[model samples]
Target: MIQDITTSIRTTVVLWLLTALIYPLLILVIGQGIFPAQANGSLIVNDQGQVIGSTLIGQAFSSEEYFWSRPSAVDYSIGEAAAPTGLSGATNLAPSNPDLLALTEERAEILQAANIAPTADLLYSSGSGLDPHISPASAIAQIDRIAAVRNLSLDDLQTLITQNTEGRFLGIFGEPAVNTVTLNLSLDQR
Candidate 1:
């Protein structure tokens, strides 16, 4: 009985060692070689080679100088604890929900103040609250704000936006989108 128990224990130890160390190390090696950029979180850098941020996560840019992303459901909080809570959805408040009505009014007022025509996409938060792209309509809606702030012509701004718009993947999958950070950075170049 002791011999059988010892053999079982030895087999378990060997399997655990292989899985806990060898397997992970092998995956790491393969992944690093296969996708170096993605393995490093696909960080974007400016022309100065300074690290900006990852392309995968969304950031909040409220200033008119920069094109803004979708409203984040994250409450725009930082730190790990900001992991999203509740349903990943709009508050679904009724039209009669005073809070809902108030929020809509506030957003509309802000848009009007900036001379921006609000699009539907601008009013909703993405499921992940970390979406990095915005609908082309949303980008176009902010053209006035960006152009005025940069002192550039509306035509030039629209052209810049057109240049930055990315088509659907493989020309079929997913919708066309504009990366907010990339487009904003390109705007500075113009």
Candidate 2:
């Protein structure tokens, strides 16, 4: 019937406007007004005020002087040619997969070569492949290497780690983690 068709079209338009435009605009205004830094990617800046990176994403740090982040399946490429297609996610390789085993072994070998024992977070890429935080244990495990490379005392480095460690959400949720990006930046300052 014509009435039914008219009602249906009107309902569709109202719902579309609410979801596709008005709702998102409301959220944007609220976000920008309430949390401007987080609304704009939570970017970290250097002493010169250049945008170095975002706190929400991980970056690869191969330097022995810095604490490393979790291994990323995408190698932390956002739009680079290395990972032009996607930004995050696991390799999805099963534990029994030969490629997974080989990669794990290779990571283990690299850690052993550096005299640093590999932790779970170091050996395996996180599910998102973009986790910026590493386990407290992982950060502690690298203190000796970082201290040696940076010519800083081990006790000083340990203190820095303690200072930078972020506690769990509401003191109950996820495990404590250290933001490697922030930790490295703090090291640079020191």
Q: Please provide TM-scores, in order, for all candidate models, with all chains considered together.
A: 0.73, 0.91
lDDT of 1 by residue, 112-133 (tens): 7888787765776677667768
* Candidate 1 overall lDDT versus native: 0.78
Residue range 1-190, candidate 2, lDDT tens digits: 9999999999999999999999999999999999999999999998789999988888999988889889999888755655545578899999999999999999999988888889999999999999889888988888888878889998998888888888999999999999888888899999
lDDT of each: 0.78, 0.90
Question: Against the hidden true structure, what lDDT does model 2 obtain?
Answer: 0.90
* True-structure RMSD for candidate 2: 1.9
How far does residue 186 in candidate 2 sit from its true spot (Å)? 0.9
